[model samples]
Target chain A: MPAVTVRDLTRRFGPFLAVDHVSFDVEQGEIFGFLGSNGAGKSTTIRMLCGLLKPSSGTATVGGIDVGRDPEGVKRRIGYMSQRFSLYELLTVEENITFFGGLYGLDDRTLAERRAFALDMAGLKGRERTLTRDLAGGWRQRLALGCAILHEPRILFLDEPTGGVDPVSRRQFWLLINRLSESGVTVFVTTHYLDEAEHCHRLALMHSGRIAALGTVSELKNVFAKRAVVEVRTASPMEAVRALDDLPSVEKTSLFGTALHVWLRPGQRATEPLRERLDGLGIHAESLEFVQPSLEDVFMDVVERAGGTAA
Target chain B: MRRLLFLIRKEFQELRRNPRMFPVIFVAPVVQLAILGYAATTDVKNVPIVVVDADRSPVSRDLIGKFEGSPYFSVVDVTSNDGDVQREIESRRAWMALTIPPGYGDAIRNRRPVTVQIVADGSDSNSAGVGLAYASSLIAEKAAEIALQRRPPGAPTIGSIEARIRVWFNPQLLSQHFMVPGVLALLLMVITTVLGAMSVVREKELGTLEQLNVTPLKRWELTVGKLLPFGVIGIIDVLLVVAVAVLWFEIPLRGSFPLLFGLSLVYLLCTLGLGLFVSTISQSQQQAMMTAVFFFMFPMIYLSGFIFPIENMPAPIRPFTYLIPLRYYLVIVRGIFLKGVGLEAFWKDALLMLGWGVGVLMLATFRSKKTLG
Candidate 1:
């Protein structure tokens, strides 16, 4: 059976529909990413799946237990962590581990074994005596992850778990997550970081309380398979975008950092026309090259297509 | 139950690491007891009095001597000028002024009735009222003595009625004895209620509460674990403040020790439940503290008969005092400490307290369950 399954899950806060008719499923041991901008219902959906919140309608099951019917059973079978890395700051690393282990009702022998495993996994063996508040953000984040998994559940839900960590620590944290997924632990994660979302086996992009797109990275990039995306870099990106926007072959134009990404119509080539247009407008084109569509480009296109403002 | 232990242990560990909590738990109670115990007294003693003896006679001097000799009144000034009496009272140098009129000695020799004026500073109403009563009783005693002496030997003596009044529980009417026990109840309420609310709200602020909600721990387990530690702390504070009251302030503990402790536990249920209820409504520790103090603690202190007697409170507001848990606790603690009364004397109050305790706890539990869900 799939580790998690949701069908038409909906959550409403009074008049605001936070998660609207969301449906998805995650196979066991797969890394499923939920990506969205702020206030896009990613966290709300994750909360519902973890049984922390009751859905306003529809059904969800985690580890074969219906979340709305037996939330306690679901809780016992899954581990959850959040962006805040909610470890007790005043407690020492070892004390936090022991406390979480005891909270999971682990036997003393199992607690001891799990405690050692958590310490080793967090690379906190020598620093167990340090208070959690004294640790840097990276260590604290890892410690929080370790505490969440002390019961050795098969499914883990992480909500923007690496929000504020340094790049090096974020990479290290992802390594641990990948290792967990390889050990037959299903990982369900939500993040706004497009670069990190690349690590998921499959991803669902949410927008305005609804899933805008769901697929593998290459499959998502296939929206541009028949068309070409030309990068235009110049002194004035806005002027270049305006000049390229008037061309008959160009479907749409978007700014990507200092460059402009110009989408061409299917079966149409605009490289020569774009250079001639920029030269005719007297706008210097430093570099104009066709490039592969990045996830960020796909995100913008999908959100714009969904008739909502892209965050 | 085992999960509850872990949560409680975690709470204590956090408290131990907090440097600010030490003073609040240990030092603050002692300091408050020392300061408020002495400052909160209503016993009137050494009430300074200015005497204006316009009679300038031996009889007026004798009456002045009577006032000088009383422990309750101190003769601050004795002058023939009547104006000095008002000045002394207005300046707050004396709480009372006694003015004896001219011919007071001749009138007394001839057995003629005369009036003497007594002016008192009523700004401090408690001391002034007590001082006036003392002066009136002293003059009455002197008048009785003079009438007895002037009566001819075996001349038809008139029988006079006398009242033999004895104050029970507190023989000397020391306000400290009454106030110290109430302070114990007040301290327990303040500490347990405020700290309990802050502890839970702190978790909410830190986002740890949301994390815990996802765990397999039951709701009752969470509530019990969160409040039981504060309850234990409340008991310890009861022991500490009671020791200070009995040993340091010399207030008697006339009832059973176990009864006081057990009753304190019941009172703690109400306070801790209030804390839990406050936590449910507050989003941060500051909000929780404000709600506990301004909304709960202040009202309870004012209406609980801790400082003011319930009998003297406005009738419409008296019923509201029934809602304050500290009200019943003050009665119970004072009964145990002063009256040496057992449950028989205050079983009704104990039952009321139990009702309030259970009702509040159930309300708080229901609120917290809904909030968590």
Candidate 2:
């Protein structure tokens, strides 16, 4: 049985369909990334799954407990860290962890032990007595995550968990998430960072409240069937783009900065022929490079396939 | 239940950390009580006066002397004419005038009654009342003195009709005796609502309410968790006010301490629940405070029988006052403190307060659940 199952879940705020008939299931210990633009039902879906919101219609079960029927029971079985740091700013780090632990109804001894464990996991153990507000933004995010996981629930939901953190902190946060996932806790996360999406074992890309695509990293790259894009650096890139537009091998050409990105057919790589053509115009190849599709490319390809609503 | 205990501990720690709130919560009430205690009083004396003795006679001079001798009136001015006295009153420089007609001392020798007229500015009715008390007493004393001195041997005198008044509860009838209880009632309303509303609003602002919303702690548990600590602070405020009333103002407390405490707890529910209710509706802390002030302050004071008797309010307004919880609370507090009344006199008020407290808390708790919906 799946650790989390959502079927035909629909949410609406008045006429706007926030999560329109989206459904997915999370396997235990899977790192499931939910990718969407801001306001694209990512946090809303997380909130519903976490039992923080009542669904407008449809049903979800987390750890075999119906979320809508007994939300508090569902809450007990799941851990959630929202994008905004929810730990009390005025309280010390130890106080926030101990407080959240006690809130989950943990016994005193267990709460103490778990507090120490979480603080160590978040790398916030020694700063236990420091006020959360006094910490930097990255530390506060770690503290919030620490508080959420203190109870060791079977499943965890992180909503854009590393939103404004620096790249280094973001990498560190994801590393911690991977360690937790290894311990057999199902991790469901949402983020705008396509790079972060690359780290997930599987991901669901949503747009305007509907799932645009759902697949593993390799599957998404496979489905991103756009041809190899060659960057031709030239002084007049738009002129180069226009010159390359009518090439027999070229599918589409657009200028990016001072380089012309030429999407050629699958059989037509950025081969000697394309380079010879660009050299024919006064635009030298300078340094030509063929690019592999990134998760960002997959995201953009899927978003474009779904009508580019994210832009 | 355990979650609620942790929340309360967290709340206390937060309160201690924010040093700014210390002066506002602890020191403000004590200082206000002392200052308001001095400014407010039921005892009235020294009403401003500009007396014009038009008739420059010995009898008139003697009457003016009698007026000045009275403690209730301070002779701020001896004006030249009635016109001058009117100008003084209109300018708000004086609040009273004593006028004596042209009379000779022989009018009293012949046993002919002479009348002296005392006029007062009625713009300030309390001052007017005090002024009236002084003038009437002066007349009564002089009339009795004359009646006794020139009485035919064995005739009845005017002194036989004297009446001695005994003011119970507050024997001195100090306004603080009345204002202090009302201040406490208002204080509870202000602090409890602010604390309750602020707790929830801060969670919403900091995005923490959503964090706790999924926790094992239930809605009702969260409700009490947010409110109980502030309720404790409110009770502490009540104790402070009681000390100020009983010790500083010398207001008599005739009822049991347990009764006061029990009533305070009941009233706290209404106030604390009101704060929570506002917090649920408000999107921010500023909105919560504005809502509390706009909706709660005046009605809590006016309808609570604090400034004016609730019964004496207009017939249309009387029924609406029952909805104001402070009205019932004031009755319980005043009845306990002043009248020394037991459950026999105060059970209905106590029950009304309890009902309001429970009703508001339940409504607020349900509203919190609906936010998710």
Q: Name the candidate that leads on lDDT.
A: 1
Model 1: DockQ score: 0.70
- Backbone clash total for model 2 is 1
Error of 1 at B269 (Å): 1.5
* Per-model RMSD to reference: 1.4, 2.5
lDDT of 1 by residue, B1-373 (tens): 8999999999999989999988999888988998889999898888999998989998998888899899999999999998888789888888899989998999999999988888889898888899999999989888888899999998987788978789999999999998889888888888889887887788889988888888888777878897788888887898899999999999999999899999999999999989888987898899999999999999999999887899999999999998988999999999999999999989989999999988877777676642234
Error of 2 at B46 (Å): 0.5
Per-residue error (Å), model 1, residue B14: 1.1
For model 1, the docking class works out as medium
Best by DockQ: 2
Per-residue CA lDDT of model 2 for B1-373, tens digit only, reads: 6778898899899999988878777888888778777776667777777877766777667767787887777888876477887788899888888776655356766789877677888888877887788788887887777778887888875557687778878776667777777777777787777778787888889888887787877789888887787888888888998898889887788888898988899999998998899888899999988888887766677777878887789999999888999998888878887888988997988898899999999999988862378
* lDDT tens readout by residue for model 1, A1-311: 99999999999999999999999999999999999999999999999888888889999999999998988888899999999999999999999999999989999999999999999999999998999999999999999999999999999999999999999999999999999999999999999999999999999999989999999888998988999999998999989988889899999999999889999999987599999999998999999999999999999998999988777
Mark the regions of model 1 whose C-alpha exceeds 4 Å error after superposition.
B153-157, B370-373
